[model samples]
Target: MSRTAWRWSRRPSAPSSPRSRPFRSKPGTWRRCSGANAVMSCRSPAGRRRHRPPEEATMQPEPITCRLIVEAVAEFYGLSIVDLLSHRRPQRVTRARQVAMWAAKRLTTRSLTDIGRFVGGRDHATVSHAVRVVDELRERDADFRQQTDDVVLAVEATARTLARFHANGPEDVDPVAVARRILATPRGVPIVSIPEITALASAVSAQELTDSSKMMTGPMKRFRSEPRDRESEFDLYRAVAEVLEADRALKQAQWTHGERGAQARLDRGLKALRETFERETEHVD
Candidate 1:
């Protein structure tokens, strides 16, 4: 043991500094902290204390205006206010008026009595009855149901645009021009008799015939008979016409072909046979 040279060796100690204190929040208190610079409280519930963003409040309902409701109804029914208020009870007009009454009651906050007064001073009971009638008709009739829905949506849109326009100022747009545009649009051709089709085309100011098409092709025959047998001849002609017209349009289009020419000759032969049937029917009649 060389005691004279022995000495104790010690490890160097870390430098001492003040420790940062942990945040302590009071019970039920929300911390006012922000972003990455935030310090969370140990007492807060959860994985991390995050302040939630404020939620948006619900929108308030707008006040319903009388003009909006009336205009909406008029535009939807494709009728003027004067006509709607008239006492006419035609099927289409009455149906449209009833629909207007129904829409006014539904879309506006006005009382039933108020709605009735606005709609040509009708009684509240009458308005109620009209609404009920339309409701029942919509359930029973497919066409009526579609018409009602289309009118309702159109009126609602018109009402909204009107509200905005009035709130701002009067609009410069011409309503008549808008109406003419709507009228100019073509609609689907409904399946109807040839006579009815001609009438409709005339009413719409459309051409009744074009160079590409001919009068509908149908069987035609002439038979000599006594004056009393005229009804039988007419009936025979009608029956033949029905058969020919009932054939597909494509088949009728091909009627000029050779095969159809032969069929036409055969059809003529059948008409000769019809002579006997006509004679028998004439005697029976």
Candidate 2:
């Protein structure tokens, strides 16, 4: 045997002192093992503990109401007003309740506490759980996520419509301009028909490019069309589009060229476009 084996044979079978005891792990708690590599190992794999999620934080309420979120969700899901307010556990109602909780958190400035209370008196923890569940479902279910997004959009659109009507006045407002303005805002909802508004905006450029030859003025093309102001609906809308495009382009050119001689041309174009727009609107009115 080698010197090391002889020394091991001569040593005591076990240490007598308390200081020489081997380490052990305890239940429900972590304890590091009693060995280390030559490298610097501050924490062993055994010593690392499982992490717990952080607690929910409180928040102040926002201007948007909890009722608005709840009603919108309930309506989209075809559930009764009492469905969210009551303790019923029909799968559909439960889904709606959870979605409403999630949306209330998103749309309203309401705290988790208030969100829970409004959505069937759930507590903050429950509300948090529901929010997580809905998020997971949205990840797994594309259709469910789409429906939820659509409902949220319509509710926001309704809110915008009300706010716009109140702020911009009820009469003589250009619906297309208001729609474009709203669409320009970040996270803004479309108060009116988004498609129609977009179509009108696109037609502005298209009509400007079109020539007088495409006017559809021939009897075959104008058949049965009750024309007003000697121009059909298509002619009138196209004229309006041309005018709007001219005005928009002039402003762009002015911004690009500033007070250079190019601005004189833009100013003249704007004057003509405004006159044309006014004439067309007057004919329609």
List TM-score per model, in order.
0.36, 0.36
Per-residue lDDT of 139-202 in model 2, one digit per residue for the tens? 9999989988997897777566555444321121233456567779858665655444533433
- Write the residue-wise lDDT of candidate 1 on 139-258 in tens digits: 999998998788767765554554544443112122233435546765943344443332232222111111001222211211233243666656655655543443233234442655
Computed on alpha carbons, the lDDT of every model, listed in order, comes to 0.52, 0.58
Off by over 4 Å in 1: 1-66, 163-285
Error of 1 at 220 (Å): 47
In model 2, residue pairs whose N, Cα or C atoms come closer than 3 Å (at least 3 residues apart or on different chains), thus clashing, are: 62-109
Positional deviation of residue 18's Cα in model 2 after best superposition, in angstroms: 99
Could you tell me which 10 consecutive residues in candidate 1 have the lowest summed lDDT?
A: 205-214
Top of the candidates by lDDT: 2
